[model samples]
Target: MARSSTNQNVHSADDSSLDAGGARALRRGLQLLDALLDAGPEGLRVVELCRACALERATVHRLLATLQASGYVATAGRFRYVPGPRLGRAAAAPGQPNMAVRLQPVLARVSAAFGDAAFAIVRDGPHSHCIAREVGTHPVQVLVIQVGTRQPLGVGAAGLALLSALPDAQVQQIVAANAPHLAAYGGMTAERLHLLVRATRERGWSVIGNHATRNVLAVGMAVRDARGEPVAAISLASTLARMPRERQQLVARTMREALAPLAV
Candidate 1:
């Protein structure tokens, strides 16, 4: 009887501790939600939210994921978080298209011009997700990543473009966070990613090969939002034969011309 009573007491204590932890998480989530709301439509970057909420990056990232999953927070552009549909502040109107739909025409134009696959990717925390893709009429195409595919940021041309556009400090933080998963994608390491970022920044574009797909080459350009912040990236991919050094530069310039008039 004594042992049974002790077990019951321990279980109750454990339950109580769990309840306290859950309550704390709830409070932190609410705090992050409030911060997103306060930032208005332009939204706040992770760094900005960290500064405003006085929270650690990992904590803020976890809370934001929960909030985003619940639809109370949404990504505004590349790295900004705004109030989501649950808050009724960012709901789309009737017949209004989202970012992917709005970008389809641009993707089509790029693919048509190059006879290769064009892709658009957006940053989601430490990862990049393909939100749109268009295939050209080429006889042989390199369709490496499809829509809805997610991979660590800096692993491919489009992802690297997105990574390169972020602040240097945030970039370092993200690279460290994604270090463990880097080996799965072509043995990528943090140091290699840092070098890639430097090269991309210096070249004003990104070109990566044999990272996301074997023997495939891609050229990527970051698309800016209205505020001149990177919101997404566009990449054109083909075989190495098709994307020689000169052709890579040509593709980059084509993407730049195509995106000259639009902002996410």
Candidate 2:
């Protein structure tokens, strides 16, 4: 009886030690996730994460590996890490409905002003998901992207605007990831997308043609969250002839004005 009691005690102690170790690991992992969430889409490198979480490099790496494997975190480039598809999926559960409903008014105002179709899209991992759309009173409407449409980031004017707002390093990483699918869209290539990103940054808005839709031109501007992070994009689309250089500028300005009062 004495020997059996000693064995049981030893087993209980072993289990207790394991439970404590597991709990510590879970806490460290949660800390890393908190840091990533606060970082938003811009993400952070391993070193940055180490500093943010105040954890050892090896500990962060192990936790990140587990998170990445479970799809809670993703690599932005060779160095930086961002929230992954699983995290986005979790947010989508409570986020998509609110985002779609809230942006309807903003889309309506922008479309009403421009007399064209206005669309709102949010970044979903490497893709852009159209959550809301409003059609204007124009006789000839450009309905390129509809509500619920999903496309690779940088494929459409709205998506491109969001993409251009990301850091250049993250941009390259996304472009490279989307390279294989670019050919299906108007022969778009990594090189071409990079050029467009540069142009969009320089112009302070985004314009793309013959890509999302044939013979259609779209102008887009990014909508930022309170943190000034690009969270969504607003775009207006029209026929190529209706969106000449001068008209594009006017549309961009109109969108900016309409969105000025937007809280998000």
Query: Where does the lowest 10-residue lDDT sum fall in candidate 2?
Result: 92-101
lDDT for 120 in candidate 2 is 94
**Candidate 2 wrongly placed segments (more than 4 Å):** 1-35, 38-81, 84-97
lDDT of 2 by residue, 74-143 (tens): 7765567888767865876444456667678888987888799999998766778898999999999999
Q: How close is candidate 1 to the true structure, as a TM-score?
A: 0.74
Alpha-carbon runs more than 4 Å astray in model 1: 1-31, 37-65, 71-96
Candidate 1 structure lDDT? 0.86
Could you tell me how far off, in angstroms, the CA of residue 100 lies in candidate 1 after the best superposition? 0.9
